[model samples]
Target chain A: MRPLRRLVLAIPALWLFAFFLAPFALVAKISVSRPLVAQPPYEPVFSLADGWQGLWDKLSRLTLDAYALVFSDDLYLDAYLSSLRLAAIATLLTLLIGFPLAHAMTRAPRQWRTALVLLAIAPFWTSFLIRIYAWIMILKDEGLLNHALLSLGLIHAPLSIFATEAAVLIGIVYSYLPFMVLPLYTALEKQDPALLEAAADLGATPLRAFWRITCPLAWPGIFAGLLLVFIPAVGEFVIPDLLGGSDTLMIGRSLWNEFFENRDWPAASAVAIVLLAILIVPLVLHERQQVKERAA
Target chain B: MKRGLQPFHLAVLALGFGFLYVPIALLVLYSFNASRLVTVWGGFSTHWYEALLGNEALLASAFVSLRVALVSSVLATILGTMAAFALVRFGRFSGRTLFAGALYAPLVMPEVIIGLSLLLLFVGLGIDRGFWTIVAGHTTLGLCFVTVVVQARLATFDRSLEEAAMDLGATPLATFRAVTLPLIAPAMLAGCLLAFTLSLDDFVIASFTSGPGSTTLPMRIYAQVRLGVTPEVNAISTLLIGFVGFILLGAAAINRLRKPQGSG
Candidate 1:
């Protein structure tokens, strides 16, 4: 019994330890290192030839320059702030769009439920890169959207909203709408028909019933969906990079540029560490929500 | 029960579905466009599809992405199923909390942090960053999802059936094989499908972990899109989307077939 249990325990533990936990420790280690012109582009923690002298030298040379650089620069700061602003607004928009759709799915006939669920998840199977790419096609000048609006007589000229913050918002909302709806639908689906009926019977209007009954009942889903959208959206790189113009300053893009374009490993690691640090709060809350769901 | 679904809810859902699908529809529609300009609708042609056959880089990347998705998803499913089993069946062992913590952490960790950290780990360990590294990276990201899905399925399972198998003189492993594995096969497949698509669609992590020769489909698409929109991208994307759609349909059909097996 014990050996079998031990074998069961060892596999996942070793894998996570080697792959997940160790990598994070390396990230933390590299964030404090100095960037150099050498291969790998970061100074080693120590050299074995110098023995204790090298250890002391490494300790002395491990400066917080990367941390200082990120703090000193307004580009990273603005990126963080803008990412937060964008993620927050996008989360709200996802909720507004997802709630009704999810509610409708819950209320849908049983046979149609599968179809609705498939419809919801169908796009997720497709390439995310492509979905965002599709938006570029739609929103570009002389694109389908502008052509339609032009023909519809909605406006005299094409609205050049592409490459703007609004486009980024659209991309985020479009991409993450499913995340919001799936959880919300799951929570809303578990609602008792009796509860809503009782509220309606007790002189509550439909809107009032939804507010008092459905909203409160679906709080867990709302919270789950919010965290799901917000955390990823905050660190979202692809959407803002592809859809956004030069005016947009998002941290994920900045991190990419810092690493790839600048080849500054330490600086990029510091940016990532700080991004993780700021995002740690919601990440924990999300874990807590998952635990609660599992427990329930 | 007087269940009244508001007209507003139905409309909103319709709009949401429209919003979700129209871009995809447009991409499919334009993949056949005779015009080089993505926006202009030329008469239908199969030229872009022909063009895709000649692009070696895109073809190679697509092949690499498929291989990586297949390998990583199979690996992730096994590992994640083990993690799920441990969480569900192992019962209050030491470091269980830590195990649970590690299991859930990747689900929410930002791709940049995950990607950057793992890349650094590879460089630090002197491991080559290419196909295998991507498989490792994807498994790390995807295992959590599989664990979650399998764990949910396990939570609803009937433990007494396993007991019944045990009572029939079957060993624990046998019981699991005969009883548990069959019961949870659908969910496990679903989890694997999830992992596969995740690996298929992953751009950020693959970008960070992948070295020169292992460009995936997303990486290729990203590079192409960066150069600006082209009908070739539309054609390729349309094909990829069609492939995924087929997978989903197969899964749904399999699920429908499984229901009768479960009942009988």
Candidate 2:
């Protein structure tokens, strides 16, 4: 019975290994390959090709040119910084909005809690691209936002809102806010109310009790939600591509352009490899924490 | 003391909900506008929605997306449910932890990385990147979700019933089909629904895998979105949101019905 059980695990395990891990290993390998003159970017070295000259060519040819290209390029550097800045700000905004909203959902009448969660998650099921596009109609020059502001005499002219950094930030936060809310809500919901009462009884102010007791208790969920939003937001291509102008370059779009436009797979893979390296620490930590939670 | 609702909190709640819906609602409202300019309200008219009906390309993409979702979600549910059953019902093994980690790798791995890597894999293997490749990709991602949900359901399952069935001379497969299948049907259905939703909404992976002219609806919308917004896309957005809203309500109704009759 145990043997049969082990066999069942084997198939799925091997599937992930072959498809998931192997492909990533391939990316890392391709990132190190030599670039050719005219014939595409990559040229594999054959061991049986010939003499000392061939051996020297293969041995000396493992170049960091691709990685060097990514680093030296102004757009790539700017985009990387912008992606981080935008993602950081957006994750913070989501947390600010999500915390209170999630808290409200948890504290709401029990009958309404499920309804609120459904409401929050319903937008997620709708087409994500469409939702981002919807923001364009609202944020553009003659869009709904301008129309509203103008009609209310709040502004003299239509605001230049669309395709700006603000527009991208709003779109990203709007799109991923539900992801932030659900996990935080899960964490906040599990907090024992008695702990808060205990804090208050011990002469802590309500705000102090919340900061020390509630926040610490819910840190796991906060961290989960933060990582969840941050990681995706960093690699976010669509929202930034659509909503951001030349001023707001992002790493995802740079990677996209490298592959689709430049036809430089090695360079694209290099960018991706660096991204993977940067993300590996946070991702590993997140998974470890999740596993610990599951065990508990 | 009468605990009145805080006006500030009420205002915040109202604004938050407004932030969530106003853009989407504006999009829906403009879908009926007569003007080509998405922002301008040239009076109430359903011209774009009417135009959308005649757009063969949009319809074809929708069809492709539907087929992918249906096939992949079904495949994921079956494979995932079986794997979950094996993991829970069967005793622990040497590589159980490793197996569990491998199963979940797809779930949290960044979609951009997954898509690029998979595309690279297809290229390396000399496999054509198209609809079948997309279906394979979707199924792999969907399976992780299904496995997680089904494993949760199986965690609290009563094992004695299965033991008794075995003692009564029922074959393992027969016992599984007759007893276990009936017990975890809700979870199985939930897993399927979840898979369907994920596969339907997936854009990044599909964008990477889908060949030219095989654009999914999201992909089409994305292509349009880069240039500018259009009422046609807005109409599609409205339709999708409406469909999702209906599903959510139905799921809630089913959940309510499943609760005990005398709980009140």
Scored by lDDT, model 1 comes in at: 0.89
Task: For each candidate, report its DockQ versus the true two-chain complex.
Answer: 0.72, 0.49
Q: Which stretches of candidate 2 lie over 4 Å from their true place?
A: A1-3, A35-41, A45-62, B1-12, B86-92, B95-98, B167-169, B246-264
Instruction: Give the clashing residue pairs of candidate 1, or none.
Output: none
For this target, which candidate reaches the highest lDDT against the unseen true structure?
A: 1
Q: Identify the leading candidate in terms of TM-score.
A: 1
Q: Name the lDDT value of residue B223 in candidate 2.
A: 75
**Candidate 1 lDDT tens digits, A1-296:** 48877887788788898888888888888889999988879986455677887788787878799999999999889999999999999899999989989988887778888889888977777778999999999998778899889999998999887899999999999999888989999999899888978887888997899898889999999999999999999988999999999989899999999999999999999998899899989988988888778867
Candidate 1 local lDDT, B37-133, one digit each (tens): 8777789999999999999999999999999999999999988998998888888888887888888988877788889988998899788899999
The first chain of model 2 has a TM-score of 0.91
Summarize candidate 2's per-residue lDDT along A1-296 as a digit string, tens digits.
56766666666666667667788887886687755544335655445656888877776777788888988988788888888899999999999998887876676667877877877876777777778888877888988889889999999988997879999989889999988988898998898888887877798987898899889988988998898788888888888888888678888888888877887888889989988787777777766765666445
For residue A148, give model 2's deviation from the true position in Å.
Answer: 0.5
